[model samples]
Target: MEENAISGDDNTHWFHSNGIITSIDNSQKKICVDISQKNSFFDGTNITLNCNKSSLDITYLEAGQEITFYFFENNVLDTEVAIEKLNIVTP
Candidate 1:
């Protein structure tokens, strides 16, 4: 199984991660997530997940909230990333 594979049978390279919503940019339809803590799926300290590219409703999201999301780079073009799922994490 690959580290970021969606599943053993799936060939797609999907990754799951949870982080605090450091900021929300409705104008750009992007949310800045802080993944600096240990256990993050990726190494970046912060990543801006594009809501426009995701299938989620960003209208209900707010700053300081924790959320878990799944994303994957386009198989055809690795540079093109998309968020497949997003959910608010409740404490």
Candidate 2:
């Protein structure tokens, strides 16, 4: 049996990485997540989240909070992905 292909904003690239919020650069519209794991999913990854009007709400976020980010790619645009959800599980 062939496995179903994940596509179109369905988060085919989903993976969990524990990290602390190193900094929040509102001016740059980016957040620096410092992953401590040597083989972390985001070891040196500087993810640039879409914080536009159409993007997910992030007003509740704060520095040093451990959050689980759910990423979903845009169906229409392959290069665009947005944070589908964020849950703060730790401080």
Per-candidate TM-scores read 0.69, 0.50
| Candidate 2 per-residue C-alpha lDDT over 1-91 given as tens digits, one digit per residue, 9 for 90 to 100 | 1112334434464433344665666754555555434332232534444445356555666788776555533321322224555566685
- lDDT, candidate 2, equals 0.48
lDDT of 1 at 69: 72
TM-score of 2: 0.50
For the record, the alpha-carbon RMSD of candidate 2 to the native fold, in angstroms, is: 6.8
User: Candidate 1 residues 1-91, lDDT tens each?
Assistant: 1235565444565767677888887887878887635442445557777767655678788888988877764421221234777888854
**Cα lDDT listed for each candidate:** 0.66, 0.48
lDDT of 1: 0.66
Colliding residue pairs in candidate 1 = none
Where model 1 places Cα greater than 4 Å from the true spot, the runs are: 1-4, 8-13, 36-41, 73-81
Q: List the lowest-lDDT window of 10 residues for candidate 2.
A: 72-81
